[model samples]
Target: MTATDPRLLPFSAVLSSLENEGAYAVMAAAAAVESATGKPVIHLEIGQPAFPTPAPVADAAIAAIAAGKTKYSSPRGVAPLRAAIASLANRHRGLAVTPQHVVVGSGAKPGLFLATLALVRGPHDHLLIPDPGFPTYRAMVAVANGTAVPVPLRPDMRSFDMPALEAAVTHRTRLVVLNSPGNPTGGVVPLEHLRRIAQLAVEHDFWVVSDEIYSQLCYEDTYTSIASPPGMAVRTVVVDGFSKSYCMTGWRLGWAIMPPPLAERVELLLVHSVGCTATFTQEAGIAALAGGGEVEMLRREYRKRRDIVVKGLNAIPGVRCDRPQGAFCAFADVRSFGRSSKEIADVLLQDGLVAVLPGTDFGEQGEGFIRLSYVSEEEEQREGLRRIAATLGRLRPVKAVA
Candidate 1:
């Protein structure tokens, strides 16, 4: 506990470096607003699914607990859960992902972090992420001591800019993070773009870490995976989980499929970071994958909700929005409503009593936009839209006082 002994210091370098990340800032603000107002905030910021975990999944967890299956399991994951994930992969993506290649952790984020650690090598190694991308990717890269290089996707919300991605590659670029049915904007990466990115990764000898947690939640087209593309398996590491797909966030269970060579290191990293996932939780995840219809039903509802939000947002004057193809978010360009996305978010929070994630929270390009999660009840969706329209009007170019 000496001052010279850095481990005993009051400050932590890792913790200090992550202080500027904005995901938690939005959460904290929402928490304070909810507590202070005592009126429920129309929460559009979090990426959580509003649907309850399926009865079957919940039942399985209960049954496992009743049967006293709470003991610690292997760091890699329980045999049956990983096997079920592999089976699901084979059936869905035509990839023969074996359980041996799988490693499970608390959630998809942790698995992603572990993948970053295992795949990112040495100082100044770089990972590519989409502009206005998942904020966690940048945080994970920083935590791994790897540089994050932005690969700006098309602003039209159509596909990844292949040239930008290809041009960003270098020897130090060890990982390329891909998200389809992306978070901030629900744009699905077209198969063609994925193929080009995969080809570039192959040519550059870099790995692709595909976060496919929202694979089944697409609206217009079926989900595709880099691993399923020809000649991609050896260089692609798939990170997925039951949280979004099964509404099983509290389960703290997610799994990763890595190239066999990297599987051991990822598992070891999981061991040191989290030791092992709860055995009962993995058991529940097995039940989720073994039966997947509830997720399909949820997807139908989300498609409906997305329609509601897109139509509503577009109706609001000066708030242009695109209909997202996948994921349950509507990224609306609200620059006309306010000077900044954060300002629009603040106005909504105060005037409309709704809180959405400002686009700036995602990245620099997100300044004039805001991400709205349409995971509320149908009635809430309609009412919130009404409120947003009225609220934005009130906040519009304030030349006069009411």
Candidate 2:
């Protein structure tokens, strides 16, 4: 009866389907624990690099701001930045792309969201995403009003179960999202798997959205893109950014490379939404692309951290961790302790004063596991591992539910 009554306002049903990234929630809880106890907390939750932004990138942004480059630019991004992105793609991914094929966004997330929006039409359309993958993949599908079909990863947690993926594809499938050197698991898709996925996309006429934000951090001999397979270039959308490798998470610059026509539409979505990424950040992106030495050094450091985490986790009584081929997170199996991922993560944060993410935060497949980021200092990682082992040891194992 009142103007402000709940009955008068209807919210989109999609609101209930959305979920927050678990890292932030765990981060806050860890902060609260530290505050209450007046103790320092070891951080292994958030995924950003511990290194500062490379000096060249910081200087470029400052110079751009001083030169009065703060005004609005094309929603597609500044010409130089776009060109640099295209060049990076061509050299790294073996794709022939021009500036017209690039559409920049505030971060890799926007590019991923826009790709979903462009492909998924309605509930009738389905998007296949990895289970225990980046949470945003499902969130984007929900926002686009498309059905999300989750394909389980293989038991190794390194790649998709091909049989499961093939069976999941239906005529309604419009998009399939791939994150090589994926989040949470740190699994890198093998080239053979990429070829198979490419074949499936071509047969089903579904577009592939490859999230390669961590491509530069790969510990393997070589990184391959789904776009590199024949017939995939036209159908694959490569979403990447300067956040991870460049240590420029706050810069908020990312881009998608697609066919020229789709790039145009994605750019239009950009125009109506966030308008354009910050102009000075684009300048910094150009410098990041040009400076590869620091990127390699960071990759080497991450490899060392990964070794420390995986080895230490294995030393724990009931924990098992595989060496991550890429990315900076170690997905450790803690099921032997007979606790849910959330329960283990909470104990780690509240008792051990160490921050880590519950595996369920990624998806149902992440249950019985915990994700620990190795982006902190090497000593901090060791200390966090010690705390985790001690905290987990205190809890007696309960019978696992069937």
Candidate 3:
């Protein structure tokens, strides 16, 4: 056989079904556009916060390194950090968790993967994920060799379509992933919806993986967790991280809170896979948990950015945007222009030099919309809005007068 022969090796068939998050792909394409044209691309594609890590958080990490706390501690996490996480959970979500229930990982993705792997046995298992949701939930289900059932969002894009979600659940359903203040759309699941979901999980005897990375970024008066409802704390895995809230994306610190039994299993998974998250990073997480003021400031700034982007998008001739309740994205409706979301996104990138994601990148339900992250400065966001309006104006649809 030749060195480059197709039959040289066998790869897992599951690899063929896996799809990546669209943000990275858009980022790469934007980079190429910037390379080809001398103009800098206005970035609205990526979800990362533009803010720097707070000084106290950075100082904590530095102090830990100076104290030589660099070795692997416990797969469950260091004692102090775990305790801090549990305390934070209790304060925010009304949970009575303890350090024993916390398991730290490199990022929320690892905990999400481990939770799916633990619950999903094989292709017979079904996992319900939000349509117009974070892509990682589906990707993790694929990794676990399970069937992913997409639950479409309601027309308002504020929460799941309960009728659709109710119809999607079956005896084979093993898990459901929930993301409040969710990605792409910035929709916060209402408390009543969470209550209904909690009831379903109890009735169906399935697990819930609640991704709350954006919990601190909520613009609403309060944030609710599905785990807060009765009987949910035992079945729910609360996956959160310091990346989005603390601007510690590069630090790679995230954690999951679950029942002690499952926490043990997930810790074992951590031990055999990545071993443990960096000790110093966990120390930084402790500081982040204590530094509440910095987080509130970040949240306030994000709210301002959200207002600016939503208003600007709404002013465009064919574009309409709802004010996002939380998170830092503007999901703009572009169906009036008579084009697919991908086509609109491409025109925005190529013609306007603005980078954004097509809504279909989230799921089929996102067909007529596009997602733009408002994580950049207010000035940059306005500039991106200008480009989108100018580019899309050329394709504006004509009105038929009666």
Q: Against the true structure, what is every candidate's RMSD?
A: 3.3, 2.2, 2.0
- Judged by whole-model lDDT over C-alpha atoms, candidate 1 comes out at 0.82
Better of 1 and 2 by TM-score: 2
Q: Which ranges of candidate 2 are over 4 A from the true structure?
A: 1-9, 396-402
**lDDT (C-alpha) at residue 358 in model 3:** 97
Q: Kindly state the number of residue pairs that clash in model 2.
A: 0
Estimate, for each residue in 40-137, the C-alpha lDDT of model 2 and write its tens digit: 99999998777999999999999999999999998999999999999999998888899999999998998999978988889999899999999999
Candidate 3 residue 251 Cα shift, in angstroms, is 1.1
CA lDDT of each prediction against the hidden true structure: 0.82, 0.90, 0.89
Backbone clashes in model 3, listed as residue pairs: none
TM-score of every candidate relative to the true structure: 0.93, 0.97, 0.97
Measured with C-alpha atoms, the lDDT of residue 241 in candidate 3 is: 94
Score candidate 2 by TM-score against the native: 0.97
**Candidate that beats the other on TM-score, 1 or 3, i.e. the better one:** 3
Mind giving the per-residue lDDT tens digits that candidate 1 earns over 63-132?
9999999888898888888888888888877898888988888999887898888777656788888888
**Total clashing residue pairs per candidate?**
0, 0, 0
Which model scores highest in lDDT? 2
Return the clash pairs for model 2, or none.
none
Q: Order candidates by lDDT, high to low.
A: 2, 3, 1
